[model samples]
Target: MKQNYIYIILFISFIFVTLYIYSSEIKEPLEDYDETKNPKLVFNGHWSGLFCNINRLVNFLVLYPNTREIDFNVLASKTHHKPFIGENIEIFSKLFQKYKEDIPIDTTYNYDGLDFTKFDLTHRKAYEYYNENRYKLEPYNKAFNKYLHLLPHLQERLDKMVNEMRSDCQQVIGVFVRSNALADEQPTGIMPTREEYLEAISKLDTFSKKTKYFLRIDNEEDYEFYKSKLSPIYETNIKRAKSNKGDAPHASGEYLSLEDLENTYLEIALLSHCDILVHCVSNMASAALYMNMNLVSICVSKPAAQ
Candidate 1:
């Protein structure tokens, strides 16, 4: 029995040694890829926020291909599935308490509100307090970092669009018009009248006798309304983007639904294509400044209501 026990002990020690050697041989140091080394393409919309959660996820899968270390949870809160500045976080806090997970970090950014003394300051302060208390949304930082990694690529996308527009028009003047007409909602600020739009174009035409303008808006209704108002002013030189519907509206009152694809991406692309951007108090106009660095930015102030 003693001899048998000794032999068994020796066999176990040999097995351990063999397993350690095999493990050492199989292990390799992980390599980190610098995402910023290449250009990036940002895909987002108004509801998507600065870091488009879904679009970025897709981009990661397509761009990284083999990267497995990229963990989305490490960056964003589980509540991010339905993100709102202050409202959703409250719901998340309640859920977190029930689950007893590690406390989340606060990640509140800046905001500009129309009212401060009233309910506005209360809302802003709540967000600030939340930022002070919660786990910071680390994903935004990662997303922004990845965005910087592909800045050159995004710049290239911008450059390509610029070159194409320049070739199409003798001179390209980007026209950004307000788009609050959703469900008959009025846009804030002093919107340019038809005459004003024509006057602006007339002034631009002086730069090039055959100057053409690129107009971007949310809905086809606004596009047609503006086009009809401007055609007599710019004549046949006027080129509005063809409606994806493959048919034109019969009159000013006609409405057309926009493509269901992300509105934020369309807004960003439209703003990027502009040489000069005109915007109102709409959220897209508010956030446009952050996304498009090269455009000449202009904000039309909202008119006071009676």
Candidate 2:
């Protein structure tokens, strides 16, 4: 067993060496697509979940277009789990390290006046248009996905979750359901009913020809609720990450260690790998798109006051 582990380590090391050599020797340049010609995008703003922050980063980059390097160290994660800043920096740094060779990523963090959040846009309509449906536009989605990729660590974690589902032939479908508690916080401002989500899932299953489902629920009640509802038809499951059950764990006053936070992201990483995803239009929902996964986003808002 120890010898096997050693061999695995050596194989991984060899693969990295081969990749670095391959990247270095490639002198052929695509002048049109060269980022060195473009101005760099310095990222620093609302660091939410994996999806939210990533979506914003992708949106901003797409809107701007010309960029040589992306500065992300200052863009801290705004997780409910952590109280102060710098908690999730390690994970972000890891992501930067894993993708730096491809995108020339800069891992230095800074919060001076240079923060992207401080930079306000005068044209709201133009900004919103490019940011919302930005990826679908020319050269945005294709370019972003090319540079952004999850590290092998996250990929291995996602693979473990998929294997745990133990589906023999059932196709995996991901369902992203937000809770009533987060209704006001959601971009859409309205929580889809259990029935509405079920309908969406049924349609997704039919559309994708999938038999298994992984319902990624934020609240505990919803987890049990969907498990019961989905079990009757498709092979359904949820990520059993710590604090994944019941109410708002972040607001629970518990200090979410770096490890716990990584577990939380592991769930998102797993969801990103699903065969098909039915999601609400939010940052968490948008994060999956960078992985080149299929997405169906549902957005419904509460009626405005008269």
Candidate 3:
């Protein structure tokens, strides 16, 4: 019996040693976004913030082939599936949790279509080509929008919540006002103002006694400011995102934890259901545009004034 036990222990040790050797042999070439050269074309970027980063991902994927890995470590803090603002971490898996195909790519092979392995973010010439010439959506890429879909569990929860919010049966409109924590962050020479919002609201001929609105603004004060200014006949719903110091609204505060990120996305998803979108130049609005391409945008700012 003693001899048999010794032999079994030796066999297990051999197996583990072999596995470790194989793992170490595997090369993670472009581990971070800055390196940029990968055997497979890695779609990655810095964390400009949630919706903005997602827009970059979606827009790039829309024009590219489907068989690439989302290099989640770009601005991510850790390689694991958590939201680390100081670092990107692998939040992609957590954010788009339900996607099951063409993801978690193998290191063995590349996509069958156009090979952009040599290209990186510093080169954006391809975007100019596709944007001007062949901007039309191909059937295969139409599902690219699904890339950012919420996990099944969150979807079910939000669906019920959104349904209840809209149960009053009204003409619902979503308004996204873009602002951030720093006063200097507002776009120079073209910041959106109360006057612009009022002018946009006045043109919403669809507003009636039954009309309801969802204001997905940057700050709680802005939320109430817009809410009070809009016609009294309409109702307003605002998602109270957890305060991040002054980075309220849809921003990740000092830290980007999983819960804060999830709520920000939830606000975007729920806003997609609105009958119309009155917005500033916001990536959150771009997210709603993902769901309804034809939705009318009431641009709160007038370029003529600028």
Which residue segments of model 1 deviate by more than 4 Å? 1-162, 168-171, 181-196, 199-206, 229-267, 302-306
- Per-model C-alpha lDDT, please? 0.36, 0.51, 0.53
Q: Which candidate order results from sorting by TM-score in descending order?
A: 3, 2, 1
For residues 1-306, could you state the per-residue lDDT of candidate 2 as single tens digits? 999999999999999999876544332112123444444454554544444555555655554455555666433433533332344453454454333334444332222222333222111222222223534433435656755655677667667776875355356667777656555543345666777777766655454453667777776666777788765223333333333333565554544555555666666667766666666544555555454424433333223343
Runs off by more than 4 Å, candidate 2: 1-41, 47-50, 64-66, 74-91, 98-140, 163-166, 185-188, 204-210, 232-247, 296-306
lDDT of 1 by residue, 1-306 (tens): 999999999999999999876554323111223443322222222122322333333323333333323222312122322332223222212111111113332321111111011221121121221111212223323433333322344445445655666664554455555432321212332344445555655554335444556666544656777666543221222223344232322112232222212232344554545555544333343223333444544433323354
Which of the numbered candidates is closest to the native, going by highest lDDT? Answer: 3
lDDT of 3 by residue, 116-151 (tens): 233222112222212122223232135446555667
Candidate 1, residue 166: Cα displacement in angstroms equals: 2.8
Number of clashes found in candidate 1: 16
Clashes of 3: 8
Cα-based lDDT at residue 169, candidate 1 = 53
Indicate the residue-level lDDT of 203 in model 2. Answer: 59
